[model samples]
Target: MKKKRILSLCMGLFFSTLLYSQMVGIKTNVVMDALRIINVGAEIGLSKKMTLDLYANYNPWEYKELQMMKMLALQPELRYWFCDRFNGHFVGAHIHGGVYQAAGIDMPFGIWPDLKDHRFKGHFYGMGVSYGYQWILSKRWNLEGNIGFGYARVKYEQFECKTCGDKVGEGHKNYVGPTKAALSLIYVF
Candidate 1:
């Protein structure tokens, strides 16, 4: 019931934005694609220098019996273009939320040292600021690069391994680091 309401609200907002937007862009993050995570985004021009972007990604494949990465995430950002919407440099403020299940993966910088040996199922929410640049590739295509940093509040239950049912621990963690990265291919209409 709660999930449905959230989904409905997002859909409503997306449609309403589309109705008033002068330009709309559809995009896919190549970085996510390379990792076998499917992702898509839509940017709606709200003004000459402003736009709203909605992005979502999903990963559901298991690499092996003991290794897996399954997740779904959604992010929405409001951007201020230094030059014009969908062109040149921009800065944005964004909020993100997601649920994940991961195991048998080494986290960079030793942030989650136990992840390589344990499984974690969790949910997280965060907000951040980002800087990005977009280049016009053709009359209807563009390329974009963006990065963001911020904090996330994560809550998770730990299991001994990917297939283990015994819960070993559960806790909340506050993390601060890179929150968003994207190299996207976009088409404008």
Candidate 2:
């Protein structure tokens, strides 16, 4: 129910922004790709100093062996740039929602314990503010580096088996930490 509402709302915003913006662009998050997750996004110029970015990422490979992550995330952000439409320093506010499954991984900062004999699956959503820098490579090429931090609320259910997924328990976590980190390669049109 909640996921449906959020997805509908974001889809609506994506379409509306597509219809209104004069300049639009496509981007790939290299950080995600390097980690075996697929990521793509669109950027719409909103004003002389502002832009809207909508991005989605997914990890489709096996989580247990290599990546240790299985998830899908949708993030939309409004950015205020300091110089021009897509260059220089910028600040952004973003909201994101996603589904995740984790198991047998000892996450950094005590974010996750070694679920050596179990797994967790559930949803999470949060908002954050970020600072970034964009460099112009050519007339239509750009490179961006961004890091965001704020809060996250995760709700998940434990499973007896990482593969079979037999439910055992449920839990929630509140975190104050990094929510987004992106190194994007963008193409403008």
Candidate 3:
């Protein structure tokens, strides 16, 4: 099946990268965790100053009958370290894709004015650029912070409330603003 093929390809890529990488880091974004979203990421050193990073996050719980923040997201980035891999400053280019179901939430910056009164289920895809800093905490741990800004093309179906299945509107939106933010704990090897 298609799912099996995708899983197999991902496993092969992961293992093959492990074989040749100079270093690998496993990380979790604490910001996402604080919001009850589960997230994990890996950074594979491709060269002395370059690395590939992959990150994924998911949330599936509803807080109340009409309050929810449920979604799955993935982002992959290529980074160039200013000093050395996992050391100091870095810049990256990344692509992101995700699906979300949200209701009764007040989004920051008034990005989605109707979210607090309506429910939305949608998928989005986009790209962005980021700047980040990583601080070595010890022999095998690090702290990292990053922020990115760019564009997302969102397509969604709107409903009156979280449990209301009656679709009211559906359309495409072009969004521009902050795309990523992370405060992460990383274990390096």
lDDT minimum window of 10 residues, candidate 2: 60-69
Candidate 2 backbone clash number: 0
Q: List the residue pairs that clash in candidate 3.
A: none
Candidate 2 residues 109-134, lDDT tens each?
66676465577888998999999998
**lDDT string, candidate 3, 54-121, tens digits:** 88888988986578888877788999999999999999999998789999988888888888989999
Ranking by lDDT: 1, 3, 2
- TM-scores of the candidates are 0.94, 0.89, 0.92
C-alpha local distance difference test of each model: 0.92, 0.85, 0.90
Q: Mind giving the per-residue lDDT tens digits that candidate 1 earns over 1-189?
A: 876787788888888888888999999999999998989899999899999999999898989657888888899999999999999999999999988999988788999888899999989999999999999999999999999998899999999776776899999899998999999999999
lDDT of 3: 0.90
User: What clash pairs does model 2 have?
Assistant: none
Between prediction 2 and prediction 3, the one with superior TM-score is 3
Which ranges in model 2 have alpha carbons more than 4 Å from their true place?
A: 1-12, 64-68, 114-116
- Of 1 and 2, the candidate ranking higher by lDDT: 1
Better of 2 and 3 by lDDT: 3
**Candidate 1 clashes between residue pairs 3 or more apart in a chain or in different chains:** none
